[model samples]
Structures are given as C-alpha cells and as structure tokens.
Target chain A: MAVPEVLLQSGVSSLLNSINSVIQSLGVSVLLPIIIFLIALAFRVDVLKAARSSILIGIGFIGINLVIGLFSENISPLAQQMVEVTGITLPAVDVGWPAAAAIAFGIAELGVWMIPLFVAMNLVLFAIGFTYTLNVDIWNYWHFAFIGGLVYMSTNNWLYSVAVGLTLGLFVLVAADWTQPAVEETFDTPGISIPHGTSAPYAVAAIPIHWAVDKTPLGNIEADPDAIQDRFGILGEPIFVGLAIGLVIGIAAYSNALFVAESWYAILTAGISFAAVMHILPMMVGILMEGLTPLSESIRNFMTSRFEDRDMAIGLDSAILIGHESVIASSLLIVPIAIVMSIILPGNDVLWGIDLATFPFFFALMVPIMNGNIVKMVVTGTILLIPLHYISSAVAPLLTQAAGSAGFDLAGRGLITSPVADAGSPATGVLALIPAPVALAVGLVIVLGIWVALRMWPQRMYMVAGASEEKARETVERRHTGKGGGLLPNKLGSSADVTAAEGRSDD
Target chain B: MTTKNILVVCGTSVATSTVVKEALKEKLPERGLDIGTIAKAKATEAPGKVSSGNFDLIVTTTQLNQDKFDIPVIHTTAFMTGIGQDEVLDDIAAALED
Candidate 1:
C-alpha cells in the first residue's frame, strides 16, 4: 500500500511539472494576450472585440520579437566589431522603447497586476481629491511596470516592487499638475496635462535649470525655430538618421577590410537594415496600440463617467506637445549632440541607438518650461545628457536581466538598455539604488506631500513657477467656474484666439 | 467610390497617432466615408510623408504648421480625450468630400 501511494504521488508531481513547463514555453507572446483578454472581459468589453484586441496584442508581441531578433542579429555583431576595431568599450545596445515596452509587459508576475493597480490608484486618488488628473493613458502604464520589474529583478521582492511603482505613479501625477499651466500655455491644449513618465519628470528638473539660465547672459539669446527647423530638419528624419549612423559604425568596424567587396556589402546592408528597424519597429508598436485601443477606451470611459462633473485635468501622452516648432528644433539639435556625448562622456558605456529618434519627447515639456527659448532648451538638454549617460550605464545590467526574464533571446548579445524611458529616467535610476523598504518610505512621503500641496494651492504653485498674476488669477477663475477647460463647447469655439495665443506664448 | 487616403500625424507615430488612426477606422465607415490606407508618421516626418503620399485629408492630435501644407489640416485632441469626436469626424468627412 505504501509503495503504491508513493508511486501515485510521484506521478501527480510529474504531471504538475509538465504543466508548468508548458505554460512557460508559451512565453509572453501567447500569455500576454490571454491576460489582456481576461482584463478586457472584466471591464465588460464586447467579447468579440476583446478577443480581437488581445490577439492583436499577441501578434504585436510576435512582431516586436521578430524585429528585435533582426536588430540584434545585425547590430550586435557590428557593435562587437566596432568595439574591437575602434577600441571603444561601449557594448550596451540601446534597443529603444519598443523592446523596452515589450519587456515591461512580458513580466507575467508583475505585468498582470499593473493595470489594475494603477487604475485602482487613480480611482482612489480622484475620489479623495488627492489628484485632479485622471491618467487615462493606459498604454504608457508600461513605464511603471518597467520600474517595478527592475526592482523585482534586483531584490526578488514583489512587495518592494509594488511600492516603488506606485510611488513613481503618484510622483508623475503631481509633476503633471505642477507643469499643467505651462503645458497648456505652451502646447495650447487647454484642460490636458501630460503625466507621461518619460516627459513629466524632466519638467521638474528643468524648472531650476530654466531659472538658473535666466540669471545668465545666455537667457537673452534666442534661436529662431523656423531657421533651425529649416536647416537641421533632415536630422529628425529616422531613415536618414539610421542610415547615417549605420554607415558610420559599419565603416568604422570594417575599416581594416575596406578593400574587400564583402565589407562594403555588409556596410550597405547595415545602413538599410538600421533604417528598416527604425521605420518598422514603430509600425509594429502601432499594431500593439491597435490592440490596446479598445481596452484604453473602456478605461477612459470608466474613469471619465465617474468624474464627469469634477473639475480636473485629463492626463495624456506627451506626443501632443512634440509638434511645437521649438520642440522640433531643439530635438533636432540634440540628436548630434547626444551622439557626440555618448562617445566622449566619461564613465558611460551605453551605445546610443534607436531611442535617438525620441529626443523630441525629452524636450517636449522642457521647451514649454523654457518658454520656447530654443537656445536655453538646447543648452539644458546638452547639460542633462551627461547624467543621462551615466544613469543608463548604471542600469543597463538590470535592464538586460529584465529583458532576459521576459524571454528576449539575448543569448549572445551584450547588455541592452533604452535611453529615453529605461535607464535615462532619474526617478527609476535613483529609486533603484536604495533598499526597497527605505525607498518606499521616502517615496511615499515625497509623493503624499506633493499631492497635498498641489491640491491645496493649485494656482499658487503655478504662480510660484512664474505665471503672471493675471494669468494665475485667470487659471484659478477658470478652475472655479469650471467653464472653458476640459471638453467644453466654449473652448472649442475659440480656436482662432487659441492660434493667436500660440504666437504670443512662444516669445 | 474612390477610397480617400488619410495621413495621421503625432509626436511618436506609435502613440497618439495610433489612437487617432483606430478611432478613424471605426468611425469613418459609419459616416459613409470610403477610407483607404490610413498612414501614420511622426510630426517631424509629416512634410516628407505629405509630399510623397497621395493623402486626401490630414488629421493630427498635435500642432502642425498648417501653413506648410495645402491639405486641410484638422488639428484636434478630441479623439484622444473622447471629446467632440463627432464634430471632428464631421470635419474630416467634409474635408475628404472637398
């Protein structure tokens, strides 16, 4: 009887192990879609729509994996050869945000919980009047997951990861509130605030920098946005940028074999391959967004219906601000500067790649804070890129670890990091260093204090940030009256005045 | 019926533009518009795409220098915030008809 019982137990244990292995083999491509499907159904989305969107998400993941495979296969060898030939020790591949987003969502343990966690947090905050900004930009929720995944990778503690992720979410909401006046003034998008993880944190850093620059002779120098756009606009084009970098790196790597026909073929292929990666990766992400749209719309409807009558700001992606001429000019100027700095900046091992096209996002809020001063925006951006390199290098190992766990085939590839959202983030980099418990404590205090302060003196904060008395009063009055802001007919009717206001606000 | 090509532009081609594109795909056909390919590009790449592609209407969620393009540029964040979306759809339909 005892022998038969032992045999039965062993058989059951083996069966369970097989099931676990099978689930693991399915990977994020299949699993993430399952998770999304469940979430959409829970949100009461139509069954057919839920299935379709979730499958698109699965397809998006598969498409992203294919692109990363191609990108790494080509770029990894070139990066290795370049390091060998040029004697530059920069081995960290900047895989850009597309891969970063996939890795963030691939963490099954944490990714499954991120949507519910943030949505609950937003609902709670809005209920308590702790936050007036309803963050409906569910697609970018990957930022929090990325940070949480990093903490989880390091500490192996889920609790700590949750704490840090929630802390960052609160901090971003407050940053959005603090920058709302400037964002609205600069972008001419009233009633909208950018609580974007990549863009908002930079605005906090820029306020002091903008202030310091104003005290110097550099404050008076203004660069013409039209001239900069006309002169350096080609630099902003991804195909050109990719081809140029690929050719430069290819030539440098194959310098010893320049006479060989094979070397030139490799060089030219590298150029076109990179351009394809730049152009195609975002297109894949668009498909990912297509899958996400139904769910995102459901969440937005859920949140807005709950708070329809409240006076609040709608949080959105920073993409809305990038069309400003100053943003276009400053970002164009920063692309070359970033490349040069990546090579020369000491203690930096990150080889800047795909995220170079994302310079516009980094400068979006900063341009507004600097009051569209192209010179100041460029100067501050160059100065900030120094710390950005060091932070990216510091976090590259953890990012690589997270990517591996996400089932990215980083087998022979060296360490990888993203410049814009992953390593370059001050919030993620700084919080990652401290012991998780201590970091959680500090983060809570800071976020809570900022939220309370912003809630109490919404307009005072704007005034302190340099809004004129009249403008501040007008903002407060607008908030009180609940009249012209946030999807109102009166606001839409003043389109001509808003256009005229854009001209006056730029100077 | 000739399919009208529409170009959607935003900061990142992947972010807001995708949102706008999905909204258009769902809403355009309901309004009796023959939608062709809805191409997406970053705001900085808008000019190159416009000059190269035969687009009948331009819709953007961000500010574009409308002066640079002859096409009627419908710049609005309505699709993103789910506000005044019908009005913007009406505008797009009207522009495509012209």
Candidate 2:
C-alpha cells in the first residue's frame, strides 16, 4: 500500500511540473489569453465568443512581436548611423505607441490587476457621488499599466506599482469629469467625457497657459484652421512624414557615399522601409484593438449596468475629439515643431518617431480651451513639448528595460522611449520622481481631496474651467435627477419617471 | 451581388475605428450585404479619402465634418459601448441597400 501511494504522489507531482514548464515556455502570449478567457467567462460572455476573442488576442500579440522585430531590424541601425553622421547624440529612439502598448500589455503581473482595481475605484467613486463619469475606455487602461510597470521596474515592489497605477487612474477620472464641458462645446458631442491618460492630464498644463495667453495679444490671433488644414494637411499623413524623415536621415547618414549608386539605393530603400513601418505598425495595433473590442464592450456593459439610474457621462477615448479642424491643423503644425524641438532642445536626448501622429491627441483637449485659436494652440503645444521631451529622455532607460522584459528583441537597440506613452504629461514625470511609499501616500491624499472637492461643489468645479454656467448647472442637475442628457433624442425614455409617465398614458 | 465599399473614420484610426470596422465585417454579411473593400482613415483624412476612393458609405465612431463628403455618413458609438448596436447595423444595411 505504501509503495502504491508513493507512486501516485510522484505521478501527480510530475504532471504539475510539466504544466508549469509549458506555461513558462509560452510566456505572455499564451498566458495572457488564458487569463483573458477566464476573465471573459467570469464576465458571462458566451463560451464560443470568449474562446475566439482570447485566441485573437494571442494572435494580436504575435503580430505585434513580428512588427516590432521588423521595426527594430530596419530602423535601429539607421538610427545609430543617423546619430553618428549628424552628431545628434540622441541615443534614445521614439518607438511610438504601438510598441509602448505592446510592452504595457506584456507586463502580465501589473496588467492583470489594473482592470479590476480601476473598475472597483470607479464604482466606489460613483457610489459616493464623487464622480459622474463611467470610464469604459478600457483600451486606454494600458496607460495605467505602462506607468505601473515603470514604477515596478524602478522600485521592484508590486504594491508600489499598483498604488501608482491606481492613483493615475483616479487622476484621469477627475480630469475627465472636469473636461466634459470643453469636449461637449468644442466637438458638439454631448454627454461624453474623455478619460484617456494621454489626453486628459494635458488639460492641467493648458488651463494656465490659456489664462496667460488671454492676458496677451496672442489669444486674439485666430489662425484660419481650414487654410492651415489645406496647406499643411500632407504633414498629417504618416506615409509622407515617414518618407521625408527616412530620406533626410539617409542623406545625412550616407553623406560620405553620396556619389555612389549604392548610397542612393540604400537611401531610397530606407525611405520606403520607414514609410512601411509608419503604415504597418498601426495596422498591427488595429488587430490588437479588434481582439480587445469585445472584451472592452463586455466590461463596459458590466459596469454601466450597475449604475443604470445615475446621470453618468460616458467616458470614451480621446480619439473621439480628433475630428475638430483646430485639432487637426494645430497637430499638423506641431509635427515639425516637435521634430525640430527634439533636435535642438538642451538636455534632451530622445528622438521622435512614429508617435508624431499622436500630436492630434495632445492638442485635441487644448484646442477647445484655447477657444479654437490655432495660433494659441500651437504656442501652448510648443511650450508643453519642452518638458515632454525632457521627461521622455529621462525615462528612456526604464522604458527600455521594461520593453526588453516584455520579449521585445532589444539586442543592439539602445534605449527606447515613446513621446505619447512615456511622457504624455508632466504629471507622470513628477510622480515618477517621488519614492514609491511617498507617492502612494501623497497620491492617495491628492486624489481623495479632489474627489471630495468635486462632490462638495459639483457645479462650481464644473464651471471652474472652460464650461459655461448654464452647462455646468445642467450637468449638475442631470446627475442629481437622473433624467436628462440622453445620447439619442428618442432614448429620452431612459429615466424611470419618464418611463412611468409613458406607461400611465398607455394604460 | 453588388459589393459595397465602406470607409471607417475615427480619431487615431487605430483605436475606436477598428472596433467599428470589425463590427461591420461581422454584421454586414449577416444582413445580406456584400462588402467589397473596407478601408480605415483618420478624421482629418476623411474628406480627401471620400473624394479619392469610391466608397458607398462612411461609418464613424467619432465626430466628422460630414458636410465635406457627398457620401452617406452614419455616426454612432454603438460598437464601442455595445448599446443600440443592432439599430446602427440596421441603419448601415439600409444605407447600403439604397
């Protein structure tokens, strides 16, 4: 009996070991999908649908890895050569948000916890009347994961990383509530707020700049957005921007062989390659989003159902605001401005890359605050880019480390950073400097204070920024009465009172 | 079967637009609509793309300056939020049929 019992124990132990080895070998690509599958089931998604979505997510990760491999293979050596030829000494490469998002999602430890924590916090805030924004923009949750991963890499503490991530999430919710009015006025999209990490926090920087500009003649100088869009629209296209940068870098890097046909061949090849990267990288991310959409929608439905009676503003991606003419025009202008600033700015070493396309997101919220003044938007964006460059440069090593651990082949690639993901706002930069413990404590206090203030003076807080008094009062009333701000004109029957009235009339 | 071309426009062309495009791909065929080529573009590129490409309709999750295009524009966030998605899909099918 003892011998048979020993044999059974050994067999069970070996089975467990083999399963562990398989998971270790597959790493994040497999593990994340498994986690996602389980989470989908927990959220009550259909079994077949959950399986397909999870598999698609796994495929998306594989696609991202393949594209980053292509990106580094093509760009890294050219980047090194460009640095040598131009003597720019900017060793850090801006890898864009695709690589950044991949890296963020790749960190399984922090990524797994962020979704639950963010949802719980949102619910708590909503329950207490501290916030009226239900942030369903789950795709942008990578911003929290990215920041958390950075803190984990810096402090090597799981608790610290989670704390920092949660704090950033809180800040985004408040920023969204504060900026809803501006979004409504500028974009003509009602009952919507942007809780995006990249776009929301910039409102802090733009508010003071808007105030200062109003005191000067620059505030009145309104550049015609249509004319600007007509003239500089080509700059907004990624293929052209990529081609131009590649050709310039090729010429600079291969200046010694300018007379040789070989040099011309290399230059032209580089141009097309760069353009391909610019075009293909986003397509890869699009696959990731395709896999993510169902999951995000499931999560959104799960959250919104809980607060059905509340007058909550729908939190969405800042991408929704990108259609404004002022945003497009100013973003087009900021492209060249950002490139030049990266090169000439003192104490800055990060080179701009694919995230040049993200300038529209940066300027979207700021444009409305500037009252659609293109000139003022450009000026404020320029001012904001200075610190953005510095912070991006400072965080390059940590970003590189995080990217490497996420299975990105950073073999010869030196330090890497993202302009949009790494240093999208000064708030992230400041938070990165504080010790983890202090950040946790201070971050909690500040977030709680803001929440309390918003709860206490909802109308006043709404009017403090770009919102008009009437709009503020309406929003406050809607939240209290749970009756107005319907997305569709006919969907106004959502409120219980209205439904009751309709039922009585029918009877 | 007449194959209809569609253009999906959004802020980044990478985020919400992809969701809308995926939904259309899944739902349009179920509604007996044959889809030809489904293209994606940024909001700023919509006007240029519409004039240049032969598209049957424009489905967007974000705000578009609809006055710039002669093609039918259907703006909805149903795909992103998962509310009223069936109605939007019906709208798309109706638009394409016309």
Best by DockQ: 1
> How much lDDT does candidate 1 score?
0.82
Please give, for residues A254-311, the per-residue lDDT of candidate 1 as tens digits. 9989999999999999999889999889988888889999999999998889978777
lDDT, residue A57, model 2: 77
Interface RMSD of each: 1.0, 1.5
Write candidate 2's Cα lDDT for B1-98 as tens digits. Answer: 68999999998788989888888888889888899999998887787788886998999877776777899999887777666889989899989999
How many backbone collisions does model 1 have? Answer: 0
Taking all chains together, the TM-score of candidate 2 against the true structure is 0.89
Model 2: residues with Cα > 4 Å off, grouped in runs? A1-24, A480-507
Query: Model 1 over residues B12-91: C-alpha lDDT tens digits?
Result: 88988989998899899998889989988888898888987598789998899999887889998998898888898888
Docking tier of model 2: it is medium
